[model samples]
Target: MDRLFRSRRSTVYSTKGIVSSTQPLANAAGTKILEKGGNAVDACIAVAAALAVTEPASTGIGGDCFALYYSAKEKKVFGLNGTGRSASKMSIDWLKKNHPQHIMPNLRFKSESVFKVTVPGAVAGWCDALGKWGSGKVTLADCLQPSIELSENGFPLSQCSADIWQGEVERLLQMNEKDENLKLFLPSEDWSAPKTGDVIINKPFAETLKKIAKGGKDGFYSGEIARSIVKELNKRGHPMTTQDFSNHTSTFVEPICYSFLDHKLWEIPPNGSGIVALLTLGLIDSLNRNGTIELKSMKHNSVEYLHLIIECLKISFRDSDQAVSDYEYFKKKFEADFHSDAEQLLSSKKYFDSRSSLFHPDHAITNKEMKEGVPNDMFKSDTVYFTATDSEGNACSFINSVYHGFGSCIIVPEHGFALHNRGGNFNLNPKSNNCLEGNKRPYHTIIPGMITTESTTNPAADEEELYATYGIMGGYNQPQAHVQVYLNMILFGMDPQEALDASRISLFAHPEHKKLSDRGEGSDGPSSNDITCVGVEDDLDPDVVEGH
Candidate 1:
């Protein structure tokens, strides 16, 4: 019996509604919304706001967001791109004129530098989602009330949050010993990180939240808050202006999709990397159909299965790396080609047959030699994902992030919030599709995922059955993790908790990415060239362990 059930905890069973988040406070806030007659979207807003307070290191009002909402009435999924754009003046030309030495397309400037900040899109995104899908049972102010109270009254720091906060504060301190941006996060007497249970408060953040709640989106975008943001940004030598904030608007776009087994997976289109996940699913389906890798023959978590999945991920990432661009570029090309390019690459049998020919059943590819594709830099993402499902069947998959922990470490001293470093993801090379440009969105790693079953009668129609609103929130790991979690539920028939608790495999070496190291701007640690340095738990089958 013990061997049969390996989950850390039992799956939660809820009838009226359910909310899941990284922080308990966020989960509670979302649940409270649902209990108070709010739908999934409204609950999501509450959860997102609470997370902005409780998980400040990874998320905040200063970051960006992406959402996938499953509308029960329409029986369809909707996509939201709440991402912000780069400053109109912060271009490669500006870099050449200001700081010439750090102009490399791949190289990043200091994380704390002002150039890394983008006009935050989260506030507008939050308002936009509520306006479009909210139940009207709760206003934006109501959804934000929990977060405001949490920020003003403070909450005991959890162990995981405390550890991450401490490390980030240490990192920021090293970058600038006297940097006032992170002063509030630092301890007054003890230089050490706050221990678990330590009460942390941010009255300024509460006030800021109150202003936004009362003034609505305009409070943040058009009024005093926007002015203060621009003033502080300009004071730090950043090129951001009030117009940048005023012009910000979140978009409702068509969600990119691919079919897997009995379900369709949906994600927001680029400049986000959501397409990578869809591409991976397409490749897997292609491989299974082509008879190159029959998943039916390989056991789940078997060495062969793991290898196949890893290879598919690398290949998909390589393609997405070359293809994903600003929404405007991707949309024009996709429409112009009528999606023929995407179909030929992912759906057509001919392309998969060719790709399948490259896979060798028994050997591992070298680091440098690659006809298929090598992994790029390890994705170092710090983000949070939450899901809210109402009794009415509407579900919202929400994700928010400040990019790296504590974002740019450029806290808005008056507002008590950090600015995100999303702009750092943009390339400076003119030849690249994702090249840094004024007023353009950067390549985003944050993505939310949705899965829905096909309609019983009209299988290809837009009216699919809502299955689940699920997502995993690591940067580069997101898509790969999504693949694994999908397989866990679909292939292995595990409940949510069991699916989540199942052991994970982390691939460190991407032939395309430089091995991670302290030397690199975004790297968290040392890198390894060996592709086989995959992280697997000790609890896995001995056969799988021995095979690796």
Candidate 2:
């Protein structure tokens, strides 16, 4: 597959700096910052803000963000969790009493539900990142200026963003009638989605960005923006308060790592679902070490290889779903009950071996047979992921998102941005680790990935050097893509572009037929025979598909 696969773009190289993203305009914004002598973090924040304006359907300031930064000077990695907590006054008991109709297994709140909106955390994350890792040559206002200009002066909608926006037209139109801010997105005379090449001017959103630039974090969290958020949520019968907005804070955490191919893969632990990628890699590594499978000997995307990868991913997801949640909750539960923390437990080779022992080379494991591994208990989200590397050797892997397209579809007219429905992921069962609770973050999906290797010159000193900053943006596709892209480069020796462009497989529950037993209409409840499907790209070998 490596020899047969080709990339549309060549591997990009730069001695000064490089920034990569989905939108050209956003990329330009980051490069502009880099040209202005800003470091990778500064460029990343610029790119993130520009994406909010250029790719509104996928990301915005009214969302959440996470970042992993590799410091060239310190020779280490740092993680920031910028996800918001649920409203302090809301909980499972309150939700059940007020909205009993929504109670169900694996329930996701409707996109338009006010109760689904959590405090927006992206602004704080951006501000905090700049304060901690910025080059000090640029200010918050400087990083955001490009986005403000694009919003106020207008920019042509890119073809990809236009297509995504058009697909969400129905969802946007179905928003609450009082959400007049929807007009900012429906700029057409007929109130339809804007087409490609259309110049979209968002003066209101520009003004909001200006405020944030001028006042830093407080500009969004405690000023008129916060008041507006609270008022809009309150009018919709949500229990959100201004204090909830003010209390939002991003957490700094040490990254968790797994060794593979003589390098370390770093991920922002648990709550971000990066553990799934680590566990999947660990399982494969364990299998290879124990002579259960020989990955290099098998053809990429062959029936045997695809089946093995899919099975490992399924096992990882099952364990994550049972265990991943708010980091605070995870620490409390694991420390008091299990006498260990998430990073220590999830990264253990013993646990990985215990889970990998379940894999059978010839037999596919059914959902019923895959249970959470005893050593642990664990954690979709739409998002934008981009990476930047500076001349100084620092790298930043950043991801930002507003969950589903158009987020909650509950636009704030004055702010010209939509609230995110991250609260929708909260479990209703109080016994679950991810159960809905006040002032607690729900399971998060956005994660930034970093790679590092031991310093060659100072191996005895334990010094490290940055290898790469990378991520793939999609809900559940993230971890799966991370694993595939990493292996494409390490095992197959593909360049960066080929690694990303290579055909991949994803394992997920079938949306329409969630359970095999309840395949008919009105079958929305969980059942014993849930079906997990393997999705592959069209370019995959036909024989491999048939064999699988």
| Cα lDDT, all candidates | 0.76, 0.81
lDDT of 2 at 74: 81
**C-alpha lDDT (0 to 100) for residue 99 of candidate 2:** 78
Which whole-number lDDT from 0 to 100 does residue 506 have in model 2? 74
The parts of candidate 2 lying over 4 Å away from their true place are 1-7, 105-107, 178-180, 329-340, 376-381, 513-529
Q: After superposition, how far is residue 87 of candidate 1 from its true place, in Å?
A: 0.4
Give the alpha carbon lDDT tens digit for every residue of 1-548 in model 2.
12244557878899998999988899999999999999999999999999999988889988999999999998889999988989999987888898766655444454366787889899999999999999999999999999999999999998878878888888788775634577799977687889989999999999999999999999999999999988988888889999998888998877888888887888987567888788888899989988999888987778888888888887877777655677665454555432235567655779878889999998888777666574643321467898899999999999999988878888886788888887776766576666678888877778789888999888887778887789998777788888888888888888888888888987656666542342221112121126777777778888888888
Q: Looking at model 2, which ten-residue stretch has the lowest summed lDDT? A: 519-528
Point to the candidate with the largest lDDT.
Answer: 2
**Residue 346's C-alpha lDDT in candidate 1?**
49
TM-score of 2: 0.94
- lDDT measured at residue 134 in model 1 versus the true structure, 0 to 100: 95
**Per-residue lDDT of 296-359 in model 1, one digit per residue for the tens?**
7777888898888777666565556454667563454444432334434545556556555556
Which model scores highest in TM-score? 2
